[model samples]
Target chain A: GQQVMQIPQYQHVQEGEDFTTYCNSSTTLSNIQWYKQRPGGHPVFLIQLVKSGEVKKQKRLTFQFGEAKKNSSLHITATQTTDVGTYFCAGPVGAGSYQLTFGKGTKLSVIP
Target chain B: SAVISQKPSRDICQRGTSLTIQCQVDSQVTMMFWYRQQPGQSLTLIATANQGSEATYESGFVIDKFPISRPNLTFSTLTVSNMSPEDSSIYLCSVELAGRYEQYFGPGTRLTVT
Candidate 1:
């Protein structure tokens, strides 16, 4: 089993501003996946970063995995109302097991 | 990816009562997991469900408290036994993808114990 932690449990940003959240794991991960859960909504699949030092982007959202595979980050450029939600980073243990260890998550509040 | 349909999306019950939440996946999976998300907080792993074997629960969780059942690959159930208000939270069921670093979750069952 692995433990992942996210910093700045809560964040508030104005519309058009930038926002970022970080996820750190106590143990090395095989891969990392990020998810978003809007208020009163189910968690939605967002993105996954596998390789070390890998960076991927979707529109204004950017995701990065640390070179050591022990940490990851999600950065948003020009935040909007739709970006309001709790973001979580999950670490998959290995190829054999399908269990994914999840981080506490960072709650983002976007104000227009 | 898998589509999950969970029953009893939300419920409010008195203290000492129990609740059973069901998770049904469209496709068969080798493994399934259960999680709990508290109010204004994050998700915590409850257990990993194996089709033919008993589930392996994480620390701070016990089978007597959170009894889980996996009768087959595509379905499972979790019962919160003799619950208290402290057990109020959202319960989610998920299945992981083989060789892929992802897990698809159900809509979640929100519980409110009074």
Candidate 2:
């Protein structure tokens, strides 16, 4: 079985501050995907990282995958009130497996 | 990207009652998955529903407790049988589009078992 662990289960930051959440896996993953869930909404797909040591950016958010493909991180620069949500990192059940095993997720709260 | 819709956006059920949630997708998809999210917790994979066959449940889930049906490519249902107070959670349906790494989720059905 594959397990994914996320750090900083909860985070509170002032508006305009930065935030980062890290995810680690017990085994190497073929790819990792990030998702965001609002206060009372379903989880939404954010981004996916496939190549090892890959870095992708969307607006103010940046995603990075470890060289070993066993870990990943999401960093948000100058967070805003709209960034309040739970961020989750998910990895495939196995190599070439479409099923995903999700981490516990990091809940972010921004104070304006 | 695909458009997904779930029936009965939220429901309150008594213990020992069973509730069936329906998931419908606008476009055809190869794989559909069900997930449960407990209060203040993350998402957990419950099962994978493929068209024209039995669902593949996770380690703790079983067919008797969480029976699932995949009648066609764009439709599926999950029935939570003999549910208890602990079963109160949000059930989400997701679909994996062809050649896409990300799975898109439908608006979850919030279930509260009293």
The numbered model that scores best in DockQ is 2
Clashing pairs in 1: none
Query: What local lDDT score does residue B87 receive in model 1, on the 0 to 100 scale?
Result: 97
RMSD, one per candidate, in order:
1.7, 0.8
Can you write out model 1's per-residue Cα lDDT over B50-105, one digit (the tens) per residue?
A: 89999999889999999999999899999999999999999999887664647889
**Per-residue lDDT over B4-112 for candidate 2, one digit per residue giving the tens place of the 0 to 100 score:** 9999899999999999999999999989999999978999999999998789999999999999999999999999999999999999999999967689999999999
- How close is chain B to the truth by TM-score, in each candidate? 0.97, 0.97
- Which stretches of candidate 1 lie above 4 Å from their native place? A93-97
Candidate 1 DockQ category? medium
How far out, in Å, is residue A9 in model 1?
1.5
lDDT of 2 at A73: 100
User: Clashes in candidate 1: how many?
Assistant: 0
